[model samples]
Structure formats: structure tokens, C-alpha cells
Target chain A: MSGEMYIPTYQDMLDAHERIKPYIRETPVRTSAYLNELSGAELFFKCENFQEPGAFKVRGASNAVFGLDEEQAKKGVATHSSGNHASCLSYAAMKRGIPCNVVMPRTAPQAKKDTVKRYGGNITECDPSTSSREETFAKVQAETGGDFVHPYNDPRVIAGQGTCAREFMEQTGGLDMVVAPIGGGGMISGTCLTLSHQAPETQIIAAEPEQADDAYRSFKAGHIIADDAPKTIADGLLVPLKDLTWHFVSNHVTDILTASEEEIIDAMKLTWKHLRIVMEASSSVPLATILKNKDRFAGKRVGIIITGGNVDLDKLPWLK
Target chain B: MSGEMYIPTYQDMLDAHERIKPYIRETPVRTSAYLNELSGAELFFKCENFQEPGAFKVRGASNAVFGLDEEQAKKGVATHSSGNHASCLSYAAMKRGIPCNVVMPRTAPQAKKDTVKRYGGNITECDPSTSSREETFAKVQAETGGDFVHPYNDPRVIAGQGTCAREFMEQTGGLDMVVAPIGGGGMISGTCLTLSHQAPETQIIAAEPEQADDAYRSFKAGHIIADDAPKTIADGLLVPLKDLTWHFVSNHVTDILTASEEEIIDAMKLTWKHLRIVMEASSSVPLATILKNKDRFAGKRVGIIITGGNVDLDKLPWLK
Candidate 1:
């Protein structure tokens, strides 16, 4: 499974869905008439924020955890994530009654660290840099002999994330286009994988923060653009796209759009105010881009994937 | 309909459900595993906050606005409310293409006023006192000859609000008890009206803020006890129970509970952090009471009605 990059097929996603059914929620899709009127598009929100662990990453994490063989499961699963992925993996591992180890940035939000700890995941902190994360994660994995589940790069994770798109399409009947926030491109790549097969006509759009516009730049340059410790209010979207996710993003994504940090924050507030849901700044990227590029989405049936809702209530970006 | 106090029967609720089906939302019910574990109860949250107008009052507002005769409709509808009821009534009036005259305190939250205006309701500001409000409302009603839609005291409104409990029962199969915040007792009265007949075994509990515990005092004293002006973070629950609402409260409510201002605020933040939904502090009272009195609710299947979500994002209670 590790020699060459293994590309997951549609059948893989179908199989993952059945495997994770007991652990993941088929979260409800919500709509806002006011938002529809403002955006000039009929919008459907796939509320992954409503997931039990409060994120869509659970789908992929559950797939990877449950898919492991009994021998491999005993060693448990490990990942390096600064946010939702770390906690989601921990949650999945806890459900399967196995130990989970996480390598996270020392500076990650306390709320995120609390979630991972609450789920009984052992956390080893690393400096907030790619080199330090990899180095720390390597040592942790070697010591524990745990299965490494890459947050977005692995085939099993991407296929697991693809199930969200399948549910979204079924819930909305069919959409003209689907928009999702892109960081490592896991959710976007998964959306592309599902729509490219099930509903080819539905365009896949990736939204990114202008502060961390690596994905947008990569799409324009036709090559991955890795950033060095990029900073943004959308902390979840700081990572660069990996080769496996890049393959789908380069081939299937119709376009990659970027929104300013202010726009992202504003959209987050607008969604909370109008849609009446508590979601993270990262999840607001898609809506920010859609509102900024209204002409592109006007009068279309658009599906927006709300990736997660895990945020610090006391220190909201707007208040800060 | 006006001579004697008409109690809304179960049949009235059934009819109201059908009549307002097109105008209101059958808002989704949500559950939180974390909250369930913390409270020692299986809790179902009937998210009235998800309504298009962002409240359960829309059901009652829609019932009154749409059930009017053509002669009364031509004159339009009027109400005086400081919060969700104003916006919700305006929303219903706009749907029926009738003029909605809202008499509101000049100091009502700007967010609330904006909503009523956005829904095409005319706002006639009055002083923040019962006498001033009634005097101003009387002048406005006389000038327009509009029918007054009492926020909770009207039979039509009570029947309409009862539909929420009907949906709650259907969504949860059945619950051991249902808890709702008692403002003017509109929502609580409606819950009692529905459960008293539809699911007679289900107990109806009313929650109130300790700061403004008129309902709690009234229940204990075996009579009405109105507060001239009670201050609390739960601004929605400041109003006293009217005669019609009192009738249901005295006859059917199992018990009334109260929570401190700090407790209500903490519960509001906890709900937003865990349930991932934006709801008013007023709606947090039920959960606050449940958390405070865990022994009474342990091992019970309880339904908590999330009354509304029209809060100023810039001024969250916890942030303040």
C-alpha cells in the first residue's frame, strides 16, 4: 500500500461508506432563503459541522481506523494534525477501542488539544513547522509502531472523505456545482472524485483563504505550491496539497478561488447570523468566495460543504 | 372567539399544523452525545432556531396572519414585542402580503429591529414600559384598524405554537418530559396544550431565569405574580404570563424551575460550542435547569426546545 501512490476508485468510496456507517453521521443539509436571495443562487449547505465529532474529517478517519486489519488495529493509528483531523482520528480510534497517538503543533488552539485529549488520544507536541511536525511524528510513530494516517494525503482518507459528496448529491437531488474549502485539498479532492464519477456535469470548485492561497496558486501554475508556516484566521487551511490530493485537484477541479481573511471572517459571521449555525472560519471560505464571485454562481443550484464547527467560543476571530 | 377565554384543544393544534404548513418550517431536531453524557439524560433538542424567521413564534405568527378573514387581512395585523416575536410576526405578515405594524421599545436590539424592517414590517417605536407600549399600540391600531395578535395570550397563537410540541413528539417517537423556557408562557402553554392530549404521559416542565422568576413565584404562590421590570441576560423571558397562558400553566405544567443569569450564559456558550447552533440565552434556560437538577432528569428521555437564534453576533453574552 505504501510503494507507489494508490489512487482510490469509486468502489473504494462506496465500500468506505458502508464500513463507517455506524461511526459517522449522514449530517443534515440546510438552506437559507435570505442567503439564496443575497447570493442569487439556490444554495444547499451539507452541514458536516453537525457530525458527532463536529467535522467531516470523521468520515475519513473512521474509514481508515475501521478498515485496518485486527493485527494492525492492535498497534493503533497515529496522525500529525493541528486541528479537526487529529481529534476526529482520535474519536474514531476510541470508538474502535484502540489507542491513538497524535503529533500536533504546540501552538494549536487549546480547544483542539482539549478535544484530542478528551477522546483519549496521546498527544506529542511539536514546533509549529512542517519540518518539526514530520520529525516529531516520525519519532512518535517509530516508538509506538502505530499505523500512520496522513490527514489528507492517503488513499483511504480521501476515499472516506468522498462519501460526504455522495451524501450531499443524494440529499440535494443534484447540484449544478459544489464548493468546498481547500487546505490539503482532501475535501475538494474527495468532492472531485465523487462528482467526476457519479455526476460529471456538476462542477467542483475549491475555495481557499487569500492569506494561504497555495491551492489557488497551485491550480493556476499546474504544480503544487507548498508554503512555509503560512498564517491565516482559517488555521485549518494552512497545509499544502499532497501528491495524491493534487492528482484529483489538478485533473478534476473546475476552478480554485481565494477569499480575503476579512471576507472569510465576515462570511463566518453572516452564516452564524443568518443560517443560525456555529461553524469555523475555515468552513466560511466557500461562502466568502461565492459571495465575492456572485456572477459565476448566480441562478445556479450550488452545494456548499461546511467542513467543520470546532472553534474557540471565547476567542472568536471577529471579537479578537 | 373574543367573548370568553377559549382554550386551544388538541384538535385546534392539529388544524393549525395543517393551516400553517406552507408558511412555517418543520425545523429539525438535533442531539448531542457530549451533552447527553454530561447531563445523564437522553436529550433531544427541538431546534426552533432553524425556522426561516429564526424562531418558533413564526408558527403562531403564521397561524394568526393566515387565519384572518379577508376583511381583517385587509386591515392587516399588529403586535408589540421587543424581540423574536416582532421579527417573526413581520415575516409571516410579509408572506401573506399584509401590512405588519410592530410597536417596539426604542431600545430593542438593533438586530431585532433590522429583521422586522427586512420582513417589511412598519416599526412604531414606543417607550420601554407596559403602559407606554399599550398606549402607543392602541393609537397605531386605531389609526389602521388592524387586528391585534397577542404574543401569547391569543387562542390562535397558542394553537399555532402547539404544533411545535406535535412535531417534537413525532420526531422523538415519545419523550419522558419536555422542557421549555417560559416568557409570556407562549411556548410552555403550547407544549402543555399539545402533550396534555396527544401524549398524556409526557410531563411538561417550564424553565425561567432566577433573575426574573415571576412564573416560578406564580407557580409557588398559586396565582399570578407580575414583575414590573425584571432584568436578565435572557431578555426574551422578561414578559409576565398572560391569563390565557396562565390557564395552561396552572392546569397542566408539572413544575417550574429557574437558573441563575451566570448559569444561563454558561449553558448558552456550552450549547453553541457543543450543539454547534446559535441560540438565544433565553433558550438556554431549559438546559441550565436540567444541568442544575440532574437527579430529577437522570435516565429520562427529555426534549429541550431551542426557542430562537436572533442574537447580535457582535455582542454574544459570554463575550460581554
Candidate 2:
């Protein structure tokens, strides 16, 4: 495997911004005095939860699929997931009229599967574990001759993820800090890469839910930590840091912070209450961090990348 | 009572828009292929849920409060509501550094009271079922010598509501149909007024929940209907339609449509899921109608006014 930065340069992000212009939405840069006062920070929300596929995964997946050559495209695209990435890839492939095969964990919630099916993806469910999903995906890719798109740890994927940060920085000039929840390093790594160059003054913050703090631990240890066992309301943040994402984040990101389960739930409700933006627990990572570390961010210009809105209602902890 | 068109002219709406520009948000227009496809309509959601005080009611409240003379401003403004309008009036008054009084039903959600208090408004509560919140508001006004701003039946308020349609049509050219939820009929009447004169080609739809079908009954009768009991999941739509709002709706609005409780819940959830914006049951009314009457809207451009996001999470049906 290539040890080099998987993502292309800032110039590539600029180019992707143009290439995906026809497809990706330039989501709103939202602000409020109410939120500002609560956080003690001047906040700008780069609402990727409002993105076309209801997640930033679309940005990377769309770019990867569309950037492919006709010969490669004819092979179609394949992935392994049962979350936003699967649906995003499925939707993006369907948009280009390419067949999509997704190998999902058998234990993946039905909501995610239903959404993927809505976009006409063929789903193969295996054992509820990474080894099984990966093995099934490899077999499927071999069977269909489909191009495999990694969820976060690929060059094309990271390049696409960087586009969100590039657009965000352009929308709100010179942010003092940028915050986002870290699951795998796909979002924050690309975010770090983009903000490191475009708005060099901006500090990058990786927010992680405490119940699933693999990234936080990895940052502290200066190495990658792949979490095999996980339990959290934020299902999206359950994935541990991968090698490429680890390298990307270690070089570009400045700090990582954690929020407790209670904090995650509170922040989720707060986002719903104030912004009218319904987000899953993973999306609340920023709000949870901000609320927990108010002193660190007071009076600074902050931008939060809300990742997605795909939440399982039955699993919502606040349904009391 | 003035037997007149409360919001009599388009200019009033324009003036209100300009006056409230500093405080009120010109909320974004959200478009979702998923929503448009589901409803069988090309939809542009004018998101007033992001507006100041979390509702369109702020526009009128801001206009009325800011337009007052110095002596009148010193006396301040007062209103009665169990929901959005109370917060809207309080917020507008606070922005002008004026004292605001809100008389609400004691049964008003604790969330609304908390927000009003947070904004520093004086509150008076009375029985909502057995007694009139309006009569209490009048008493509060009489004692305080403040001007009474009727929730929806006021001229300045209707003018404020009209601004939504003005911005909607301005942002996206000539909508084929404009749909808004009707409670006291302020939003529909004002939106219809703007559409009738400015974009005459556009048809107006008033979305009313089946449980509270006053607007539907009024439309069928070809005259204003009042002196009736009201009930609905859309709490904001329970108030009887006023005479002034009736006249405007009768003349300009094409029809009134009703949605079931399940439709309202699903539509509300869909709006939050797709738009990532919070909307109350009242705010969901227009979306509910589109989903209910899918045949009329296929392939046609339509505008849906998301009225407000002032919902109490503690009172959420999902919690139950």
C-alpha cells in the first residue's frame, strides 16, 4: 500500500469543487447569536447534513465515481457499508447509471439498507463484523469486476472529502478553528488538509464521542488504533482510525476532544431545538465538544461541519 | 374591530421585510429530490423555521414594534399565544430594547415559557380551555398601557407574513403554487396577497390538518367561518380563522387541503430528516398536504412555507 498522503493537494480540492458543482450542493453557512452566546464562540455551521445525500460521504463518492474513465466506469462500483457511505455511493452510481453492489454487515440497521435499496443498490449481507464485510466485498468485486471505493481511506475519497472544507472556508472567510466529529479519518483528515492550506490560521479540532474514542486515543498515542469492539449512540463514530486516516490526521490536525454519552444526547437535542436540524448522535459530536469545552473556544471564530442526518429513531436515547 | 384587509397592501409587506431585515433571517429555500419525488412536485421549501424567534411571526412583531412612535415604544408591546407568536413578539420587543408582555395559556408548553423568559419577556398565564388567552392579554395591556399585537389578525402582522411569499417568489422565479399552513389565516392570507398581485399565475393552497378543518370548511362555504371549536396535532392551527384573514384567503387562495395525524407526523419527520431543519406540526402542514394530494402536484413547481421550529422536545410524540 502507498504510504503517501492518499488525498490530492489543495489544488485538487479546488478542482473537485468545480467538477462536482453540477451535482453537490453548496450547503448554507448558518450562524446565530443564540448559538454563539451558548458556546461563547462565534460559530458558523457548514451544514453538510443538508447536503444532497444528507452526508459529506456523497462529496467523496460522487467525485470518485464521476472521475472514473468510461472503461473503468463500465465495471460499475462496489463498497462495503450499511451507512451514509453505502447510500451515497449507491445514489452517486445510480445517477451515472452504473450498477452498484454493496456488502453490508448483516446486523446493519434496516433503515440504512432500505435507503440504499431506494437508490437501486444490490446489497449482500454477511456476518456482523468487519472481516466478514471485507471478505464479502472482495468476493463481490471479483465477481462483478466492479471498482472498489473505500469509505474514507482512499486517495479519491479523501480528495472529495476535502471539497467540503474548501467550500466552507470560502463561504466564511478565515475561521479561527474548524471542528468536526471523527469516526474514520475520512472527514477530519480531508478537513485538516483543506484548512491547513486555505485557512492556515484555522486550528483543526477532531471531536469524538467518549464511548467511541479510538481517534482521540490514537492522536494521544501518535499512532493508529483500530477499535474492534464498540458501543455508542453515535453509530457513525464507531469506526476506529485507519492507517491512512491516522497519517492524514496526525500531520494536519492539531487536537482531539471527547464528549460523553449524556453530552452527545444533549447536543443532539440542542441542534434539533435551535437549528431545526435533525442529526444522529455522530452529528452532535461538534455541539457536544463545544458545550463541554466552552472555555477553550470562547470568543473565537469557529466552524462546525455537521456530517449527516441519518439517525435510527428506535435507537435514539432521548425517546424517553 | 376593523372590518378590513388587515394586511391591505403589498407595499406593507415590502416595508416589513426591510424593517425586520436586521433581526429576522432571510431563511434559505431548501430543495430535495427525495421530497419532490415523494410528493410528486418540484418543491422549494422557504424555511421560516430559521427565522428570528423560530417562526414567521417575528416579521410582523418586528415591524409593529419598530414602526411605533417613541412614546408608544416606551409603553412596549404585548400579545397572547401558547406557542411561536409569544416568543416572536417577545424577541422583537427585546431587539428594540422595549418591555414585552406575553399572556399565554397556563397549558403552554414549558419549552415556550423557557424561551420567552430567556429573552427577558414578562409573562401572564390563564386557562386555555375555559378562558380566553386574548382577554388576559387585553387585561395585561390595559394595565401596562402597551399596544396589543393580535397574533394573526393584525394588519402589521399580516404584512409581516406576506414578506415570506415575497422572498419566496424573489428567490425562485414564479412558483406554480404557494402552500402554507393556516391557523388564524395570517400566513396564507398574506402569502396569497403577495402571489395574487405579484405573481398572479401562482395558485395558493392553505394546508389544514383534518382535526382542525376550519379553513377547509370556510373555503367550502365561500365565506368566513368562525365560532367553532378546534383540535389538531398542529397546535398552532387550532385557533379559529379571523374575519380579516378569511376575506384575503377567500379572494386569493385557490383551496384548502387537509392532512391526517399520521401524515403530519411523517411529513414533520421527513422535513427534519431531509432539510435538517426543525419544524412543528403546524410547520409540517404544507408538506402534509403535498404528500396527501400527490396527484395535483406532479412535475409542477410548488412553494411550501415551513412556518416555525418552536417545538418542545419534552412534548414530542417520538418521546412517547
Candidate 3:
């Protein structure tokens, strides 16, 4: 890999923001006095859940999809995701009048498949296993020649996600710390890329579900740790960190925290009760971490990224 | 009643907005492309659900609570309600550091009671009948010498509610039609008062559940139509209209529409899905009506008021 691959500068994020502005929402910064009191910290929630495609993934997806050259765009974009990234990429591609091919596990939620299809995405199903998915995705990419946009590991996608923290700093002035859930570390890496350059004083924290603590372990070990199928209700944060993400994670992230399953669920319900936003389980990890480690965040102005709102209403964790 | 009771002018709404600006939030306006396509209308949702007390009732409640004279303020405010109005009034009064006495039905939701108490409002339980509630409220008012603030009928409350429509018009640059669910007609009357004076070109529409269609019947009959303990999933909108609200509803409202229980739930779920907000079932009436009568609203700019988000999460109708 080229040295350029490791360096996605603040300028890249600025460019991504400008490029994706027309295709994405400048989602609102929301607050809850009740939540602030409960955590003993002033919390500002960057509500990416309100994005048109219902996730911050849209920002990265739109940046990558919109940045393509006419010739490259004509061939379209492809990704392997059964989560927000698939639908978000599809939405961005559809907005830019390009085809999007999403390879998903056949067992993926029907609601997710419906969203991807609704956004004009063509889906190719694979077996549930990672090897099968990879094999199937490789064949699809080779056959279609569509540009592969890795969910979080790509430099372009990382730069796109970093725009959120830029907007966050502008919207909330500046925060003492910014926390977000780590799936494949796209958002955390993006956050690190922006805050480490723009507001070095501000801390970047990555929250992970305890059950899927590969990123947490990686952060402590100073190396990438890959988890095959860690189970958590925060289905959106199932993926482990890749090298590109690990590059940012190891260098800029101040701390990586973990929340237990029960804590994550409680925080999710609390946010719904207090913020009144339909956020996903993955989004609640930051709040869960804050609540669990109140001493670390208390009395600080904290910004929490509410990642997405695309959960299956029929299979809500609390109901289950 | 005095002639002034029936004449809450646009000036009142303007003054109310200024008076309550310190206490109540100028809630964000949200939009959903999916909802726009489904209804065939461009819908701007004024999310009063984001209010501190989780409802638009706070606008009116804050106005009444804050507008009280020194002598009257000493007694604080008293109201009898089993819904958002009760907690909202309590919240407003508490913000002003005054006593708030709410006479609620004994069977009211525990969640509602907790919120009222959390806001430092004292609650008095009634027998779940209009007569009993009124009697209980009278006793509380007489004993405490607290000023009575009717849920909808009071001119102060009507003026306060009108501020929302003023903001809605400003936020979305004035819609072709502004629709809100009519219970005792507080919010609808407020919309009528503001739109009739400030934006006469904009039509004001009231929506109600078919099961509790007293507002619809009243609009058609040109008189008040009260239903005895009407029941609908939109529990916030079970009250009947009073004289003060009736004046605005009859004079300025262009239409009063009704949606079935199933339609209301469906629209509520759709908004939660697409808009990603936890709005009350009553707030979904406008979207339900718009979907039911698409030809009338198709291609038009419509403003829908998301009145509240205070619902018992444990008892979500869809889950049940």
C-alpha cells in the first residue's frame, strides 16, 4: 500500500463534506436535559439517525459515490453490507443516477433488503458465513466491474465519515470529548481524522459493545484484532477493525470503552425516552459507556454520534 | 365569557412566542422523502415532539405559567388533564419555580404521573369522569388558590398554541395547508388564529380519529359536539372542544378530517420508520388523512404538527 493510503488529511474531509453536501443531510444536534442530568455531563447528540437514508453511512457512501468520474460512475459502485451502508450507498448512487450493487447474506433482515431495493440497489445474496460472502462478493465485483467501496476501511470512506465530526465541531462549537460506537471503526476513524487535526484538545473516544470488543482489544494491544462473529444486539457494530481503520484508531483515539449488553439496551431505551429520537442500538453505545464510566465523562461537554435508526421494529431487543 | 375570550388575535400569538421563547424550544422542522412520495405532498413536520416536556402543549402551558401576574403567580397554576397537557403544564410551572397542581384520573398512565412528579408538580387523583375531575380540580384550586389554566378553552392557552403555527409558517416559508390533530382544539385553534391573520392564503385543516370524531362532527354541524369518554389509540386527543376553541375552529378552519384506527397506527409507524422520530399516535392523524385524501393534498406544500412524543413505550399499540 502507498503512504498516501495512510494519510487522509483534514483537507480530504473538507472536500468530502463539500462533495456530499447535496446528497446528504446536515442532521440536527439534539440535546436532552434529562439525559445530561442522569449522566452528570452535558451531552449533545449528533443525530445522523435523521439522515434521509437513516444513517451516517450515507455521508461516506455519498462522498464515494459522488466523487466518482463519469466513466467510473457509469460502471457503478458495489459494497457487501446487510446494514446501513448497503442502503446508504444505494441511496447515494440512486441520487447520483448510478447503479449500486449490494451483496448481502441471504439471512439479512428483510427490512434492510427492502430499503436497499427501495433505493434502487440490486442485491446479490450470499451465504451467512464470512468466507461465502467474500467469495460471492468477489465474483459479483469481478463480473460487474463495479468499483468496490469497502464499508469502512477505504480512505475515501474514512474521509467522508470524518465530515460528521467537522460538522459536529461547527454545530456544537467544540466538545471536551466526542464518542461513537465502533463497528469497523469508520466513524471513529473519521472522528479521529477531524478532531486530531482541527481540535487536538478534544478527546476522541470509541465505544464498543462488550460482546463485540475486538476494537476495544485492538486499541489496548496497539494492533488490529479481528472477531469472526461476535454477537450483540447492536447488529450495526458487528464488524471488526481493518488496517486502514486501525491506522487512525491506534494513533488518534484517546480511549476505547465497552458497554455490556444490558447497559447498551438501557441506554438505548433511555435515549428514546429522553431524546425522543428513533435511534438504533449501535448508537446507544456512547451513552452506555458514559453511564458506565460516569467519572470519566461527568461535567464534560460530550458529543455522542447517534449512528442510525434502521432497526427492525418487529424485532426490537427490548421486546425480544 | 367576555368578548375578549373569543378574540385571541395574531398579536397574542406573537407575544406568546416572545414570552415563552426562554422556556420552550423552537422545535426543528423535519421532512421525509418516503412520506412525501406516499402522500403525494411535500410535508414539513414541525416536531413539537422534541419539546422539553415532549409535546406542543408546553407552548401554551409555558405562556400561561409565565404570563401570570405577581399576585396570581403566587398561587401558581392548576389544571385537570390525563395527557400531555397535564405534564406540560407541570413542566412549565416548575420552570417558573412555582407550584403546579394537576388533577388527573386515577387510571392515568404511570409514565405520565412520573413525569409530572419529576417536574415537581403535585397530582390529585379524580374518578375518571369529567364531573369528578372538575370537582377535584375545583377543590385543589380553592384550597391552594391556584389560578386555573384550562387545557384548551383558556384564551391564554389558545394564544400560546398559536405560536407553533407562526413558527411553522416561518420555518417552511408558509405551507399551502397546515394540519394538526384536534382534541379539545387547542393546537388547531392556535393554528387557525395564526394562519387566519398572518397567512390567510394558507388553509387550516384539523384531523381527528374516526372513533373520536367529535371535532370533525363539530366542524360540520357548526356547533360543539361532545363525545362521552371517547376512546382511540391517540389518547392525547380524547378531549372535546370548548367555546373559546370552537370560535377559531368554526371561523377559520377549512376542513376537519378523520382517520381510522388502523390508518392512524400505520401512519404513526411510517413516520417512526421514515422520519425516525418517536411521535405520538395523535400526531400521525394529519399524515393518515393526507394519505387517505391524496388528490386534495397531492402536489401541495403541507405542514404537519407532530404534537407530542409522550407515549407509554411499554404499551406501544403495534407491539400489542
Q: Pick by lDDT: which candidate is best? A: 1
Better of 1 and 2 by TM-score: 1
lDDT of 3 by residue, B1-320 (tens): 64556678788889999999999898999998998888889999999999988999999999999999988998999988878888999999988999999999999878889999999999999998879988898899999999988888988899999999988988998799998998999999899888888899999989999999998898888889999879999988888888888888999999988999999999998998899999899999999999999999989999999999986667677888
* lDDT tens digits, residue span A1-320, model 1: 33698999999999999999999889999999999999999999999999989999999999999999999999999999878899999999999999899998999878789899999999999998779989999999999889999999999999999999999999989999999999999998888888899999999999999999999888999998898768999988988998999999999999989999999999999999989999999999999999999999999999999999987888888988
Across the candidates, what are chain A's individual TM-scores? 0.97, 0.96, 0.98
Candidate 1 regions with alpha-carbon error over 4 angstroms? A1-3, B1-3
Candidate lDDT values, in order = 0.94, 0.84, 0.91
Give a tens-digit lDDT track for model 2, residues B148-256: 8888888888888888899898899779998899888988878877788899889898899888887788789877676377767898888877777877988888888
DockQ of each model vs. true complex: 0.90, 0.67, 0.81
Please write out the lDDT profile of model 1 over residues B96-128, one tens digit for every residue.
999999999998878778889999999999998
C-alpha TM-score for every candidate:
0.98, 0.97, 0.98
Model 2: residues with Cα > 4 Å off, grouped in runs: A3-7, B3-7, B129-135, B318-320
Residues A62-135 of candidate 2 have per-residue lDDT tens digits of 88889889998988999988789999999899899898899988888888899899998999999986688778
